[model samples]
Target chain A: MLGAFFTGSAIVERQRLGLAARATLLLLCSGLSLVDSLHQANGSLDVLGRLSVLVAIAILAVVAGAAWPQSVWVPVAEAASVAVLVMANAGPHQPLLPYLLAPALEAGLIAGVRGAVATAGAAAAMFLAASPFEIRKGQSLTYSSTASEWVLLALATGLLAAWARRLGVRTAGSNEAYPAAYRLMTQLRTVSRHLSGGLDALSLAHIVLQQLRDRTGFDRAAVFVPGPEGELVVLAGEGNVPDWDTSLASDGLMAEVWSQQRGAARQSGFSGTKGLVSMALPLTIGARTVGVVALERRFKWEMEDDIDSLTSILDEAALRIETALLFSEIRTIATAEERRRLAREIHDGIAQELAFLGYVLDDLAARSEQEDMQGELRDLRAQVTRVVGDLRLSIFELRSEVQGQTGLGAALSDYVRSIGAASAMTVHLVLDETPNRLPVEAEAELLRIAQESVTNARKHSGAQNLWVTCRINPPAARLTIEDDGTGLGTGRDDSYGIQIMRERADRLGATLSISTRPEGGTKVDVALQARPVEIASDQGAGRDQ
Target chain B: MTTVILVDDHELIRQGLRRAFERDADFEVVGEAGTATEALRLIGELQPGVAIVDIRLPDANGLDLVKRLRAGSEKMGIVVLTMYSGDEHLFGALEAGASAFVSKDAPAEDIVAAARHAAVSPRAFTASDLAEAMKRRLEPTGPRLSPREREVLAMLAQGLGVAAIAKQLFISESTTKTHISKIYEKLGATNRAQALMSALRLGLIRQDPSPDRP
Candidate 1:
């Protein structure tokens, strides 16, 4: 009974519960033990010894529980206290015998079924040991029955506690599931919204051109933005515009409007092309010329009202265009920064560690006197060397990018050459690129797709030869990677690599196809079509002015 | 003995390379620096016979450092040791006047040999894949400018305006402009000046009065 009181008080103290509950349970157990002891007391000294022992055990348990309630040692201390209590109250009809269930229950709650069994076993042993003394003192003749009953009760209570603990654990796991699912749903919604927005500069420029064409009935129109060298290069164009200079000089009509921040018209009736009128308007936002819009009409007509409406449309669209441009620039910089950081991390952390391991292996190889050991170490070192080479390749891939100065052709050539040097496969590269390059982001995506395809070929295809061909014309590009290797294997159709390549192609409105070649290996092809406006303009340019 | 200084951002790489050099009696480990600034300071103070430079540095590009070192002393052997084994980096190191280009994955013996070669001839560029790279460069794979495009590019270089070039070539202004755009496209240049510069670099046009003189 005292053991139960101590256990209840210890649990209550550990939980820092209401004092009333702790006092009521303590007093109830104490009163029951007192009434039972007083009923069967042979002498006052015996009653005093039992009551004092109960108080001592209770004090020890409370103090231990208060000090280390959550410690692993708490259950151990509780078991010890229960054993001590059993020894102190060594009688056939011990009033505190039921109290041994307390430690068993506590152990079960903390350490599960194994702890419950162990603690109950210890309590049973203490009961058995005390029963011998009780029989010798001739206090009772039915000690064995009482002992069995006590052991059964302690075990039953401990098992019950263990079952409750498992139930609590299951509830906790379910509690976290709802929040996790909610977070994923929210994130998916955000990503879907971003996909549908399509706020990139190229798409926005197309929208601006489409709106301009709709608002103004010009035969042909083109948007020109200042290039890296301050020359006006076409950003987007619509209608049959005769190929104006790929880039206009600073003194051209478009440049003049950009410099003056006003619209200007020019009539070019001289030279074979007659009855053609061109007007240029500066796309300004807050006194800053972001770009110039050049409109060409077949017949010389009154363009004054057309110019005013066009100016209003551009004035409204300028900020959006500028924002899109800035957004793309920032995105490119962030991507480059991220790539550099990843390269640095891989180089400094894993690559360095692997190299160091190689050196350590070298030292081990030198120290080994046995030929076989040295040979094994040599093989390990070779493996490490290969891994380091692969890491270096990864870092190089992460670092390589297509920039304005090096266009796609140069970058691709450099990359293909690197691949050839790194692998045993014979690489054949054919690059045909025009001076006009795609947008930086598009070029970057194409480069990555090519890299992925090549890397996949190098790793998986057991090919002896690889061929890469790239044809780039402004707004239109086709990249083909072919290898005389084992054809596309099963179960790789939806691989992450292919999925990522598809995603990249999808973002650029390009088509990606992976197929096994007729003769031998696999072929991965990606082709981006020119915008519809470009095609229309081409057809328009075919007609005489 | 060829005294060598190591410059790599990773200390462990430097240590490994240092140990590799230590095994070779022909080379001495004079100094080591983890950044470009420290490398310059160390090289200046030590004036090592050979400087093994890694292409990636914390403060500056390794190729730029090679250029600066070469400018400081043409006789000092400079070996570019890099993880990037691309032709671009190799050519960059070569153009920056490095005596030898060695990949980090190269064997210690190869690196030692490269250092020895650098010590012997600092002016002669050497790399394992130099011949292949040179062959690739020699291949007629670049965009071929047409005869008309070439003429138009030359006129562009001579500062002839579009109208003047058109009148002189007996072509319409739009036709001349179309030829100029095609030339720019073939040359991967954004403007006439850039086209002219690319033309000059590619030997399509000359610095003299007429491109036909070539």
Candidate 2:
């Protein structure tokens, strides 16, 4: 359509040039004699006069199209526009013309709302200036109707242009914002990694603070607010603290800033903060205010934008920190639990033996007065001796495998020799195969299970002999402890032995079984296999029969 | 009279040991030394048939003196007398060439017999002797862990769990665990029961009350 219009423009301009090339044609074109005669004959250049001019131009352009189709459309638009201009000049209002609305509509299509409004305003000014001739001549023109029609045309054009421009702006703006959103999402993922990797609360807070500080170039940001019992301390900051406190305008309002979990702009327009605009963003982990980031700017800049960026960065970081803190707290709890367990073992095994030895020593001291009871005294000495041997084993267990750093077989062997020397019940440790230290969880659970089994024998089993056998092959470890003692209680009640054996086996992701030997004894067996290397051991172990 | 030599690093211990051997009518102290080198020189010159040694000597560790004495001549019956935890020194002394391992913590009569036994037997360690030998063999390693550390580790070994251990020991859970951890290190234990078992072997603790089951 534009091409067609351009072709017409070219053709009409050429014709005008051709006419100007001839003096007679140019004079006829520019001559004022016909226009003056028409004005004199009719004081108004009204409807008939404008229509006649258009018809004449139409005929002339058609007749000259022998020139070119490529240059015709612009002349057609220009001729229609010029005739309308002439008619408007001649008349105040052509109340009966539907086609008169087309020019304003075309103006709306051509240059949008601003241009159309300008054109309508210029046309209106021209009409009012020219209206004096009609008024003086007492033409009794429909001034209201004509004004209303022009106003309506201007309004319509303005509305159309406004709507189209808005749509275009929004579409372009959206395209630009999406990539940034994508970049922020990637940053979010990286932030998650950093937070989880921190492994504890302090590290998590530091990470969050760094990200917020770097992402938004706030002059100063600090997490001033403390959370629940003052346990939660904020660490991330963007700018210098002096600037923040003063706020470039000295309200001296950290409390005010913190209260408003949203961002605050305190420019240094006050006595305290004249150069700073401090922004406080609440670091919210869930609904709780774990921390608050206060950002202050000493310089006049785009402070709000930076605060917005800071808020987004803190959103994910808060969750991450909260999670990391929780994990660390849990680990602490677990360690405490583990220590208590070890203490119990020591109490059960060696402390009791030493106490017994004390009793034996007391008996021996008292018996020195009599030689008649020498045989009985000798038996007590043997018992004391056995107890001493058991105590040695207990000490070895007390030392344990120092973080599972030593090999299992060596540790077990050390265990047997030490404990066996002390106890009446001899511990014979035989290993069929040896493997590298089982990875942390596997080895730990394995060790725990063995400990439980041995303790059970020492206490309830009353076993005269204990054989701890381990086979490490096929990427698995099988532990079996056979005690020549009473069978698994003949009949059952709640005994801690089975529970412990099951718990240990489950912790290592292993299978476990307990059976009474046909030879009138009991055996506890455990088998551990490999599991996923990444995730840590299952926290809540299940007992599988 | 049977001549005797005494070697103990501690002054009081040496004095006590000297007093102990002197009490015996048949035994007479010919010489005394606080260290292995001095003890060796005295033995070389004096040639006392019975030599009393503290498991721990100033110049050397373990039972090298007993080994040194026996290797030099089979006539010397060397006895290791020391205050050792459980089997740490008991086994170590035997391995290093001591004829016997006797606790200084026990009645001095035991040490005397260890000396006399070394003098008469002059043979390999038997089952009854093996337990004492093993104790002395391991004695030099270290004393039985402290009673508290042992008690904690023993309860842990019973599979009482940390909460139960704490309750049983009347300690805070973490303290109980700390004791357990120390026991684990001393006993070379990985878990509670191992700690307990090791503790039992070390004489750091005693057995638990038996279940009321018949």
**Where does model 2 sit among the CAPRI classes?**
incorrect
Distance from true location, Cα of A392 in model 1, Å: 2.6
lDDT per residue as tens, model 1, A309-388? 77888887787677666656666788899999999898878977787677667767766899999999989988888888
Error of 1 at A409 (Å): 3.2
Q: What is residue B54's positional error in candidate 2, in angstroms?
A: 3.8
**TM for chain B in all models?**
0.71, 0.57
Clashes of each: 4, 136
| Candidate 1: residue A232 Cα off by (Å) | 3.2
Q: Provide DockQ values for all models, in the order shown.
A: 0.17, 0.02
- Tens-digit per-residue lDDT, A365-396, candidate 2: 44477765766666666666555545534444
